[model samples]
Target chain A: MATRTQAAPTTWPHLGLGARRALWAYAFLLVPLAFFLAIRLAPAASSLYISLHEWNIISPEKPFVGLRNFQTLLADPRFARAALNTVRYVAVGIPAQIVLGLLLAMALRRVTRLRGLFRALYFMPFVTPVVAAAWVWQWMYSEQFGPLNSILVALGLPTLQFLRSPGQALYAITAMIVWQYLGFQIVIFLAGLEAIPRVYYEAAEVDGASGWQLFRHVTIPLLNPTLVFSIVYSTIIYLQLFTQVLNMTFQDQGGPLASTLTLVLYVYQLGFQRFRMGEAAAATAVLFAVILAITLLQMKILSKPVEY
Target chain B: MKHVLALLAAVGLLLGLASVGATQQQVTITYWQYFFESKVRLIDQLIPQFQAQNPGIRVVHENFPYDTYNQKVASAVPAGQGPDVINLFYGWVPLYVDSGYLQPLPTDAFPVQELEREFVPMLRNSRFDGKYWALPTAVRSLAMFYNDDLLARAGVARAPVTWDEFLVAAEKTTVRDAAGRIQVEGFGIAPGGQDHHLIREVLFRQWGAAPYSPDGRRVTYATPQGAEALRWYTDLITRHKVGAIDFFPGANGYRNAFMAGRAAMIFDGSFAIGAIRGGTRAKWGVAPLPRRSAGGEASNFGSYWVHGLTVRATGPKRDAAIRFLKFLVSPEVQRVWLERVGELPASRSLVSDARLANDAVFGPFIQGLAYSRATFFVDETAQRQVLMDAVNEVVVNNKSPMQALQEAAAKEQKILDDFWTKRAKKQ
Candidate 1:
């Protein structure tokens, strides 16, 4: 029997039952690994190659230009404005969404009646299709006949130039985006709150800590992981912002002097509108670097484990 | 057993031969157009008729949303997967030609003399390297569309034909509320509409500066004449009090406002007539675009979407593509397109037809074809944007018209410089 087993081991490595199971596990993992490499990594690698050349998507000739495309992007004023707007999205939008979402989540935790219904209602906008939501927001922000302006008129107050004004368009769009994504942040915060051991809160109460102190000490610390995930996830979404700006701005897109233009929208304008595929690819590579850097910095600062 | 085996083998061979014969004779070709309700409807209706006429050929119809249509074509043609024939805006002819996306029409089949004489001269814009690349079934020209009751209320008897007269009409026809907010605009200010053409082709040229040289390399619109032309346009929004830029603000906002009787006058195109006709219960009239002076050179802007054969059509697919192209441009199809799509006929003969030419709503647009010039845009999207930004600089940012025009000229010149330099390199 020992000789036969030795022969089997030589013929097929991992002949034992545990080793066979391990081999099966590796086989199953290869499917997703192959999919990820093909679907995500291959195009990314190809895009990097294309960025070094003057790629005309239609024409056969894609002349190698090395760093010239990047040089053009760095000098481009439109690209500068788009990058600043992208930063504004992350700076203004993420904090507003997270704070509002956390407050709502905490408030809902105390409500006993129809708790599930409230959660479902709040979560609906997150699940709603973005195009439909964007158009709805556009109609709501219309300078002339939108309901918000109508309300202002009925109250004998001045109407605001919401989406049309250069000064207000960016913030107005950000507010709508915050509203759409708030429910997601709330769901995550609730799960984080639930995972906190109950004894910490009870022990704080027994030690004569006030309600505010209990929240600051017990609740806030435990929710750090959730907060970090939400911040990083929301930042990624805002960096690649395109659909809302495209739909809400409509024909003269990203305007009132391109107040709402984002880096992704600029990439689209370059690649599709101008057919400067090389420059667009260069812009995309910059965006990828910015995302990676910001996310890494966030993890470094926020990844402390709450041992308690 | 031998006889049965031979019989089975013979049956199999005969069926295989029949299939091969069928496959050899029959071929399918594809045509693509952006989704406009009327164009899509007519094309969908015409496919069966075309197939019936040529039983051995099949034409497939594909339509994409208007906004993403160009991008779709850009990606599809390069990947060798899109339509054999594509309907493109005439302004895009230069871009397509530069990219080698189009295959020029054969001179033997589509003679230059016949095309020059038969079609409106705008098809001349479709020529590149001295060869015609595309043809149109219908054409469109900018015209002033007015709400009759609103104009009458202002005591204006007919549509204003001169710039000063039109401004006077606009000021008088405008209605405001107690708070001085406009309830009705005299002239709808939508740069997204034909107003861009109004400034670029008609007013600028009529004022004194042709926007570009005939060869289209030089940017000639930065002169004093250009500043004056831009001043007149911006003055309508800022100083005139006849209309505001953001009063109604989408692609069709001004049109919708006019159709809803909220605007008295709008510089729109013949293509807008169908939407205005279908959307409103009010009385409306179409007039030729206003001139700088009462007898100024009757300048107007004309444009059309043309059917072009793509490089994708080759080998057996080329003949089918050409046949379908002919079907699309036939006299019968043009007449039906005029009725259904509200664009004027591209054929000189059909547009000059006594009955159709004399029709009140179409007469102004038809007359415009005589003097209308289709701008040879090297980059239509970028050029339009720079113009829009210039206007916004005046109305929104409070910049001077001359300064704005000067800046716009520099940007436009950069685009031209980049294009020509690259084209020279490629050659």
Candidate 2:
């Protein structure tokens, strides 16, 4: 009786159609907005709050330590190395993903036969379960009797310590990640390529433009939005790099002198392994800040106003 | 009106009886442990037996991958959920106790004196705050495992009894290529495995130093004697060149190499008895770890996994949890675990089993228990990692032994400080 005493604002007799529609839209939108706030924003805020305190999950007492955890992180060499490694993952991994993805997409655009098969072959790794892929990669990278080592032996080349060598472990992981993510990048690029009308290409050719000139002028500028999105997305992924390094590395704590350690893996070790949830939360807060700042910076720098 | 009131009271009494009947009929509880294939299989076999014995209580076993097991419990418990009973490495007891993740075993059912009398001395490592937080079915200590054929080929009739003889045997057993690349490592130097334990418990004590203070709160393994012990440990790799850290190059690489007969000898726990027996074709034997000098005191790192009743089990479930723990630690189950999982019986009575003490494969592990010392850890996994990092610094980066040892000491001391500090806050 109370709910039906008066209808909601959307059902008012004097309201205009647009106003009524907007009110109803908002009423429906609140469902998802509340869900987003609960599932995403709430936990993130709570995580930030937890970062300020000495929060061990199993313990009931969570006394606030007031940035002491962060202070510890600042002095932690593992934290420093992990942060640097995260940046390296982004700096080295993202560019390879972008360039290789673009090349593969372009080549696929040119192919006239077995197009579906080629696309499927390229995309399979992305769809394959990461844990499964990591184990396979671990075997392939084995120093003794791995398939890669066998190839090296057959070619009379020196065996490389792919995961065992501290200097090379990060790069080895980056290569695997690049291979796995290339399909996603390529698919996005292919769609961008398709959206570009053929008339622009013909228009360039008639003006005595070479193929490279046409690509440089026509394709590059038009693909600006797609490039910006990919760069921002890939940057986020590489910054939060974890599974490949964790699953591929020995003993699963980013060993080989922690060369392949990522910020997320460090956070995991802190919270779960060491039972220092406060430190882990502080580490995550730093990660969140880096991710947010880098993403905003990328979008701002890369987003150009394209004109036809 | 009086007759109607009487009928209502009878109905109420019947409903109360029905509810009591339901509560008494059955209570289901969950048990959790990390997945190791043999342990998981053994637990699976035992759960039914436990359920059958305790007809009113049903047991549900849940296993997670060893890597993420702790994380699963930590996250689940914060949300007011998880297992009624849990299994943990003995080293995790302090952390679990400090976090209040586990409840003290009911003293009425498990008297403190009786527990002390029945379980082996090493089981006392898990005790905190004047109460036993967990109990183990089996416990184990480190022993030297040698490839008999490799020793025979090197014309060494027996495993070395002293550090000097150990080096000579290692040199003779090592197989090298024309280019001096090691084909078969004389010693499987596994920092990931029990070698860290050997250095911490065996070497430090043998050379007249202790890894930690009496209370296990401070790091004290930074003395000249400590350096001598550690140098000798790392020297097997860098100075002696009998082995390299990356020879096999993966998780449990050293153990895998030993099982494949690519490495002549390795320090392992009795837990590897079943795995080694199954995985290797080589004729191998177990011997006591080498001492600093002949006829010196024997020292071993004793460790075990324990099952505990958790705080999550409340009221009626507490009894079921305790009952389940008792069945898990029973002598019959411990004996079967010895055969199946290769962990030694934690029972004091089984320590003198004639057949076990005289057996070739199990004798050394049993004897080592007489002097075994469990490293009471504030954080088991991290403390292990600190030693690994120390070893890696010396072996991988070519740092000095003393430098690595000092850095490791500082790091471990910090972990202890942070843990105790937080614990003090709670108290």
Candidate 3:
């Protein structure tokens, strides 16, 4: 029968099912692969090429300037300030968001009553438009007319200049960003919390483990993956912050002496506002490198091997 | 069946021919402007009238939010597609011209001598590199907007006529609560908005030093006169305590504060008139900006938007755009723009029109136009940011005025130098 089958039709080459399956999977992936190559990779590569030239958006000619754009960026004090502000945003914003998110997640995990309602309420800001949230925050941060200052005045406390004060503008914007992203982090943390087997907790409880000890030895290690993901995710978000700063300081984008300028905002100001596309591309390239380095560093330090 | 099929084919051919004929006759040209309610309404009205006059040409008017307008134009133009006609801020003309995004009006169609005679002297700003790049249907100049009710409450008789009087009036009009918090601001220090214009044009000119060199290649604001301008402006917030940098944080802060009766006076352009009329119940008056002294050099900020054809426009589209522009700048249309949009007419002939000159609110703005000067900006927005930063450094960060002005001047000069250097290399 085997000889007859072999002799009957040998139209196809003998290949493993796995090989055939991979070929079919790649065939299916071709559309998305081509899409990424066209939209994402092409622009990224062109941005690198554009960084080495002096080309205004409307200019027909793009003169090659070598590393002059980068040199100009290095000399620009505004760029330096923007870089520092971006670092401050990630340094201050990420931890505050992660801690608050984790604390909220921990509290909600124990609450059986109104838990879904609470979860939805916490997740609301994540879904809210960033521009609307920024406008609301801008009103709240107003020194004279805002509700926060009104309350402060009502309580006979000195009103703080929130967005107006250069010293305070960055922090105020960071607070709003954290508040907006808190809901998202909380949802992620809850997912991680739920995935922890209840048997482990019950087993620990039977062994008379205290809450602190149980959290330290059992829950913490298991939640490592979630923690790593949140840190890297929040880090990237804060690193490239644009909308909040843009909306809050709409008149003079990234202002009150540019205390709130982020790397991305600087790039935007350069490319669109200043009509310096080459310098803007250089700034973007710097941002890309920064994000790559930080993400790799995060994976190296935070991600641990998980064993069942 | 063959006859029926033949008839059907004949009808299809005729319909296709008709469509092609119709399309060939209609030349649609897009016109874009930054969103302003009054301007939008004016354009909405004008488009129908324009189309009625020119049946073969169809005008498509589009408005974008002001913040994104420049970026939209820049992106759209480079792709060899954008509005055939565009309304650009006067300060942005230089940048657009340098980038070759704008096409100068043909000399025969828009002769320089005719433009000089018809339009305000400030229209010379549109003439760059010996060409008329754009034309304004209407122009705006800074004027003092006062809340009459607040002025009465403060016991001030009228808007201040001099900077010294302005200060005293501001101090008297200012109200403070028991805890020393400002209950009402006397004046809105719009550092983030028009304060740059105020310092550069009004104050600097009054101090007898032009803000920039005649060639527009160097910033002259580092001079003693410019230093004094910066000092006086910051002192309103710091020493006088009548105004604060945060009084109105956003773009329309001064206008909003004045309209809300929170501020007794504000230095804003004629553009604020419509918003003031619509927004506030407070009695208001418009006056020319107060001078450094009662008889000091009279100067006001001449900032306006001009309509021009983009470089991408060609053939029938170019002809259509120019025709539309001529229609827009026609006396009748200019009058419509002035009456509806609250901006002064750009036409020199209309400036002497009794109806506009006799109007109480527009009179001051029109009178101020004679002394107005439009700044030559490489990148007006960026240059303004430098000025605003200097203001912030002084008022918000407590930096010395001289120090801030010096730094700003250096930065601004660098921008000018860079622009000129690039231009030279391109040449």
Candidate 4:
């Protein structure tokens, strides 16, 4: 009873060399894993929980009202408008951005002189601060004193009401957003264009394919991955659009009859402005579902295999 | 001689220990406010004075950018870790109260009778649920700010007195290029800006109907009078063409236009006087807003920023916050604020002082107090957005005034109903 043997100098056993190395690797990853769990996943799960409860941040009580927030959302006309507007942004904005990006990429690929300078010039807007770009667009879109109107007037054409009219405000903001992101999409498409083997084009020419046919049959199919990525990326960005609309329409935040209201903007308004955290959480949950569904669908439709 | 030196050292050590004890007993309270340059400077000066008056207490003043201040408060106060005292916009009071973020002033320390006697009538805005929740050092009322150079260039002799005269003056001042593009707008119509207040409170009140019901429980702007008021307001842009919908683009539109001498006339609050005086080289004059008719009832919109004690503040910290608030509204501090910040003192006695009442720039705002009404709102920004939308629908979307007002009323009523319903549930 009482024979205390000093434990044989303790060392890691039962771990094979491969297992031990893997453990060290896992140990190295643990920090980021813990960080992600704490920062991103925890808040995401809590938001889902908050969506089911009535919360006002400072209130002592947070009563659970299961599904009530979502039910209210369905009945909310503003939510409907916001959802429709978001759809409109993606439907119109994404394609325009992609097509414009592809065209610019194709044109730039043929030019060898000062190609890098041209590329940098196009990419400048992508790197510029969004707030600064938004303000510049706001000034350019001003109905009365804007440079665009000035040009139209100088040309003896009637000036178009840009951001001022509800009918045109959404399109004006969408155009700004498209322009701001076009450079990024173009760079991606250009990289994709450069990656396509020149042998395919030469082969198409040897087969008596015209320029239009070669582009349609060879380039378009091969560029599917880039097209898919840009479409998915732009869709997510357009769905979560905030800064441009906020800065351009600074007067009302989201106004001109809520014409420019997007899903994320509505979430911000509900959470920060109205302090309806429960409704905001529910709206965010809906936004998450929409983003997930659209991403999956885009992957399914656009990510089909392209054979050589 | 050695013993005498030891005795002196002992006494010096005792004094040092006693001073440390005194310093330990002192309490420091933090105060938060939105950034306003002159106001912050005045507050900075007053902090030392306050510390001197109450030696056992020290105040730490912090400020945030205006737009994010409310969000910062909402998140911080709930975590029991915000400033002991806060200065918030009067419009935000109801929302803060609903969230239970603010503590009602202790009657023993701040009696209602004293507040009523000391502050102007607009102090009524600070009272809710049978308790006074906050106090204000200064108040503001809307008035017309005209660029004198622009007006004189157009040959308008003086500020217009009636709506008809205002229309004519605006028309005369308007300068359009040969292409029919506006070079200088005669008047600014910023539906999402200050014009929102003009249409919602002043014009609605001038039209012989309140924007909301007397109890402030329902929207009342869907009526014929409301539509008529809105129609007339929109006519300035749609029919008279003196002002356009986007006359002044971006935020702070009308005020910026007036400051830049692009717009001849603008409706703004007394708080803007300092900015106008400092930022603009153009000569500007403050005048009372024109009435519906020459002899009709005069109405103006009033708003103020109120300093509140957070519910999280307790014990000696709470007591210190109260003491600081008392010192803040003291007549001496109020006078300092007025001189530095260009704000009308909230204290009735100070407001009526002959020195302020007779000043040409301050006179109109002071005179407007008699007929001014502070709008009661659950969410002032959201409600203003509704009215702004109505104006936009008419001016931009070409919706009829009646239809737009009707839609706005329904939306506003829903907001009011939601506020009351939630409040009822909480109670």
lDDT of 4 by residue, A240-288 (tens): 9999889888888766778888889899988877778898999999999
Model 1 / residue B161 / CA error / Å: 2.3
A6-26: candidate 1 lDDT, tens digit per residue: 786786875786787788999
- Looking at model 4 chain B, report the run of 10 residues with the lowest lDDT sum: B71-80
Tell me how each candidate scores on DockQ against the true complex: 0.31, 0.28, 0.38, 0.49
Best by TM-score: 4
DockQ-better candidate, 3 vs 4: 4
Candidate 4 lDDT, tens digit per residue, B231-256? Answer: 99998888888987656667787788
Error of 4 at A244 (Å): 1.1
In model 3, residue pairs whose N, Cα or C atoms come closer than 3 Å (at least 3 residues apart or on different chains), thus clashing, are none
Candidates in order: C-alpha RMSD to true structure:
5.3, 6.3, 5.3, 4.2
Q: List the residue pairs that clash in candidate 2.
A: none
Which residue window of length 10 is worst by lDDT in model 3 chain B?
Answer: B244-253
Candidate 1: segments with Cα more than 4 A from true spot: A1-11, A112-121, A146-158, B1-86, B108-114, B311-332
Question: For candidate 3, lDDT tens digit of each residue in B1-427?
Answer: 9999999999999998887677547889999999999899889988998998887899999999988887677677667668989998887777778777888888889988898988887777556777889999889988888888888888899889999999988999998776566667888778766778899888877876788877778888787777888888888888888876656656787777777788888888888777888998888898889987787779887878899988767999898899999998899998887767778888888888778777789988898888788888888768989999998888778888789989998999988898888778666
- Chain A TM-scores, all candidates? 0.94, 0.94, 0.94, 0.94
Q: In candidate 1 chain A, what residue range of length 10 has the lowest lDDT sum?
A: A54-63
| Model 3 vs. true fold: TM | 0.88
Lowest summed lDDT across 10 adjacent residues in model 2 chain A is found at: A1-10
